[model samples]
Target: MSNFARVRPIGRRRDGRPIYPIKGGSPTLTEQRDEVMRLLQDENYDGDVAELLQRAERIAGEIELAQQREARLRHLRGLTPPGDPDPNPGQRQQPGNQPDNGIPDPVSAAEAFVRSEALRAFRERGLRGESGAVEFRAAPAGTVTTTTQPQQNTRVPGIIPQNPDFPLLVASLLDRQTSDGTTLEYMRDTSGPQSTWNKAAVVAEGADKPKSGPFTFDLISTSLKTVAHWVPITRQAADDNGQLMGYINGRLTYGLEYKMDREILTGNGTTEMQGILTTPGIGTYQPGSGSTDPKLITVRKAKTQGELALYPPTAVVMNPMDWQDIELDEDANGQFRVIANVTDPGAPTRLWGLVVVTTVAMTAGTALLGGFRTGATLWERQGITILMTDSHADYFTANTLVVLAERRANVAVHTPAAFVKITFAALP
Candidate 1:
């Protein structure tokens, strides 16, 4: 952030040529570096070449120290991951370890597995073809290389490892928890407070208190189910490309999330997670007979039903097509209705003051609005774990390996009334 001065010509040579030499003013480290460059390059510089050279050496040391300090600050502020420590002050990162392509080295889990002892042993004992695929190991971790100049102006490609994880839409909206057991047992209230909460009345003195019907509840026990998929790739691909390995792992994990998201809203209880729509006793909303209600109006009406049930809906889950219509819906003046900060993107998807999850998970012409974070919970028994094995179904002989990714999870809807499933259809 410091405004370092550019190098200025100090004086003129005897023949009137401009002469640039070290001057008295306090120059910035960068400016000092420029002075050093001038002293080395200019034959007519007045200062002593040897003493000035010594000062130049000190300036170089300062520049290196400054770079390391900046890197450390960036790490502390969470700009980038930490790198190997500098053993000595002002020393450059080791020559043989740094990458020529200027990418900061980050060890992803899949890459870690490839570099692990287990994979190495597998490579040694397992089959090989011709000279066999050589095991490729990434060089020692490199520090993030950045410059003070703007990215567009910097000559070196300033690259860093971007987070490869997917933005979980539905999963992120749900209340997620870790479970130790295979089955999750939770009580779902049927009557809740609406029908069974009128018992408490004002009773004076020793008058007998009126007893109302007890709130009904059903013991819901849902078993953790596995959602998984696998991909087959050659041993050569796995060993040679760590980035590819990470890419596969990230995508596989995302696949599990995608299915889980769909299941949370539509899965039949017998097979998978008990979806909110399929769960019994939840409120339902539909347009009146022969009444034409737009999606914007339909969502508001559904939200009111949830509120009337004494559960304020937190989010609305709709098919992308439905939301597309809503976003593009025009008023009488033809102005597009939903202005979602399109000019300044990255806004959270929202509608009617509730979070909107627009995914293919929900059936077209239908929507579900719910207090998902409170009405239901997602229990993850085992998170997404990736495993590669060449021993599956003669894959070992075929020189192929299967990368299996899976997770064990279940959904529990505690208060069914806290959700409302809307059928965007008119009574026929």
Candidate 2:
């Protein structure tokens, strides 16, 4: 085999000199480095054939490296724009100028990025005819590049201010208020003690001036009540965000109105508004069987109560959970028994010819079905009103504002017998 085809030795000797190949074997480029080092240190060594050969190899290696550097310089020159000064004047250009395979240098890339970002900002701001400036900040070593500053130190997305409409659940179910806002007095006529006296039948046309009958009359009266709530917020919040104050006021009003609705439905009269649920003479139905069909009991008890009172039931109020059970009840064939389909935008609100009002205020397992409007009246002394002020103690000095929502209203059950409470046994 030819010497050029032989495999060369690798690595250095124990004496710190590299292991060179045997005669006729070609010296590897790797050995050129050691040969160059030897040439630098060995002053007394004469130029023998072997030494000359080693020197020649070292020189040839140097020439090859110079050629490669020239080629790289030529490539860089091609990339550099005309008339641009060198970034490192009077110093050797670092290999960082052109990383692996001619990729852009870090410093140049950063400058270009800054320019592009500045130009973009200028254009977005529409600052025509104005020059833009970019500031450079040295990042800590090993910091990952990011398009934006870290959220912890930068302006992150702020809490999306929430505005929810939790309007009164039961108020909407009540008949609309129509009272002229006049007086708190409500009057109803009642049968007197002798109002039920019956007349004796007279002989054909012979009436002895029907025995004088007694006439009597009675009256019923109810007064109005009120409800209110308030919220305090910074003036800056109210002023900076146009909707902030309005949202607070509206939410407070809904909260107050909702409480009023509950009070009107179930309040005890002692220190609270009188509601129909506690009114005297109101009917009550107990299913007593947890397994009893919800739909059957609801309609049957409501109709019976209405019949007894000589008035038909018009509405039913139940907890949303209880209503869900009634609405989702299935038959043996898997068909919806209480509600076949509900096209309403929200939860189901009607069932079996009665307006079904599902509210969180009503207790689960209990429902009220009655002629709500026909048997009762919602009297109003003053409608809902929203007011803002800095008049509260320390509010004006603290840059704070007070927002109030209030209403004056009362409920009167003219015919308590027209309403009925239907209670279901607890679920298993």
Candidate 3:
């Protein structure tokens, strides 16, 4: 008999691996085993470790069963060799075929043959999908294995997850509130006197009470703007739970936050929120001409300006470059200027008793010190929403899907005088 029963292949895998009869699965055991090993060696593999260990154990068990099955098939084939014919219709063993030992029962001798046939039949049922069976040894190497082209991404080892380092954000310092309408309207006490108290003095001897000019206010109205983006993915990718979640948590969600942060600080305000730097009436401080002040002193002077405006700054926002300069600054003694523990990673970033928020959103040469809790309010007409649809463009016909992320909000610098914009550029 031939070493292997030659039968047509069932089908080919996406990876160009051939699927054979006994194996009964597109990816044979070796393909799956390679995936687990590849993931273990991968530096970026984020899959659960325990699951892989369990899968390897199952694969080992299946391989042992395959070897046992091969032994049984060989024994069955040898019972009736090819080209041998049983000529008699009711063939019974003659005296020549009888056992050499005296008087062995015919029934006892037939028992061994019956048991072997039962095992072979049972194993055949498993190959036909009648029972739980995995792929087995069917390759030319005598060990089960599958091959794939290097260029085929459809049949990848495993879904590789993403981990991104989003920049330090400053939006958390600003007060947040939700709104129901598109337009956000509020009245600001724009022209408050330096001496708000004792505006109206008490009159003596029934004299007419002094009339303080009516408090001045300016109407401020801002329209909510949309921050939105979408990505196109294959329908198959969208259905993959790991791939979909990684896109949202790593890329799409990060995009929304990054755009919103830039808008809150430097948006043009015509098509976007009226960012703190663009809002009118806020104080501005720069190093005076001929003054060789460092970025650290400039930020401190800006904080004083906010205090002078009667709204002491609660937080300071600067470019990461500027913050790094400040953190690295040293006095003539060569000791660090800032007295805090420099090596403590968990320490909160603070400057002049105010919360320090460093972000690239703020220009490299500028900083903002403000009473963020009271100076500006972030109005959310709609919170961030994520939607998946196959109806976008030609995605439906092309078997593609769209993942969209959107949010609507406007920035209103209510007490404009409370914020101080600091220019760190050297003044001539």
Which candidate should be chosen as best, given lDDT against the real structure?
1
Evaluation by TM-score, superior candidate among 1 and 3: 1
Which residue runs of candidate 3 sit more than 4 Å off their true CA positions? 1-168, 192-214, 339-346, 392-399, 425-428
Task: Write the residue-wise lDDT of candidate 1 on 263-310 in tens digits.
Answer: 888889888778888888888889887777778889999998787766
Give the alpha-carbon lDDT of every model.
0.67, 0.55, 0.63
What digit string (tens of lDDT, one per residue) describes model 3 on residues 1-428? Answer: 88997875433444546556556546677776666566567665555678767877887888789889988775554454334455231222222222211111232222222223432453455346453211111111111112422121122231121111333455666666666668877776565423442257767997888766566678987799988897887756654433554565455666777788889998878888778888877778988777888888888888877776668788888888888888888888998887766585545667788878777888888888888766877777654555555555676678676767677788877777778889886533
Question: What ranking emerges by TM-score with the best candidate at the front?
Answer: 1, 3, 2
Q: How does model 1 fare in lDDT?
A: 0.67
Show the lowest summed lDDT stretch of 10 residues, model 3: 136-145
- Compute the lDDT of residue 225 as modeled in candidate 2: 62
Please, what are the lDDT tens digits per residue for candidate 2 over residues 174-263?
A: 443434343344433232112133344555666465553453222444445667787886756544322342343345645675687789
Show pairs that collide, candidate 3.
none
Q: Of models 1 and 2, which has the larger lDDT?
A: 1
Instruction: Please give the TM-score that candidate 3 achieves against the real structure.
Output: 0.56
